[model samples]
Target: MILAAGQPDAPLLELFLAATAGNVLGAVVNFVLGRFLLRFEHNRWFPVSPANRQRAEALFNRYGRLVLLFSWLPVIGDPLTLAAGLLRTPLPVFLLYVTIGKAARYAVLLWAYTTLAG
Candidate 1:
């Protein structure tokens, strides 16, 4: 989706907005899941183990919500948003940081594509 946005005839601003909106929405979903799923941690069906949960919480606490700036990252991004939910981060704070990170990522990618390909 992002790469497609960089096509020569693509509507850059529209694509950027669409991609950012969709990506941020996804992060919101992860955050919501994490916020609610922690309640079921004791269930055998829970995906995350207690030890892992503690470790994730520890990392999140140590780094704080500022880490949300990297929420645009691939492997760790989704989990980071989830951690925010688990830690009960404020929704506004989560949205602000996550949006900034995701939007910046797409902006950089678009700029690079234009610069290199133009």
Candidate 2:
């Protein structure tokens, strides 16, 4: 969408803000779902894999809440946020780190789009 907008005219700031806001909102929703699903952590049908869950937990334990900065990662990202909720990572900290990661990602994409389009 940002690239599409740039095909004609780029509102880079708007695109960045909108993308970052959406990413933050989506992660928060994931966090809420993770919090709500805490009861099912031990269930056999739990969506998250035991191995991956353990890995995310270990990373969180080692790095503390700041690990949320990597929540933009593809394979491990969602699990990281889920683990954050499961482990009771503070909302403010989660939002801060996640926003930074997501915004940085979008900023890079937007920059690349503009550079290529130009």
Candidate 3:
């Protein structure tokens, strides 16, 4: 919505900051949920399937903390954060990486809007 709007009502800096903050907060919630819900694996209502969980775990293992850099992606993003929590990733580390990813994503979107819309 923000990207497609072309010209947002709010200032670009405000938009960027708000989007980054909201996305990071959401990821944090997902992480906490993952931490507490570790024992609820395989339930029908689980957001991530067993296959997705395995894949996320594999990626996290292979890339270490760096994989959180892609946590802004759509389908796999939530699982990545959840996996980080399930794996007991440090809060400071998760916040740092996820904030960078989401801020970069919004910055790119804003740049594209300016470049292409002008």
Each prediction's whole-model lDDT (CA)? 0.91, 0.83, 0.86
Instruction: Tell me each candidate's TM-score.
Output: 0.84, 0.78, 0.77
Give the number of colliding residue pairs in candidate 1: 0
Which pairs in model 1 have colliding backbones? none
Point out the higher-scoring one by TM-score: 1 or 2.
1
Global CA lDDT of candidate 2, please?
0.83
Higher-scoring candidate on lDDT, 2 or 3: 3
True-vs-predicted CA distance for residue 79, candidate 3, Å:
0.3
Off by over 4 Å in 3: 1-5, 39-59
Candidate 1: Cα lDDT at 116: 89
Q: Residue-wise lDDT of candidate 2 within 3-57, one digit each (tens)?
A: 5564556677887898899888888988998888878878999877778778767
Residue range with the least summed lDDT across 10 consecutive positions in model 3 = 1-10
Question: lDDT rank, highest first?
Answer: 1, 3, 2
Estimate candidate 3's RMSD in Å: 4.4
* Candidate 1, 1-118: lDDT as tens digits: 4446546788888888998999999999999998899799899999989898888889888988999999999899998998999878999999999999999998998899788888
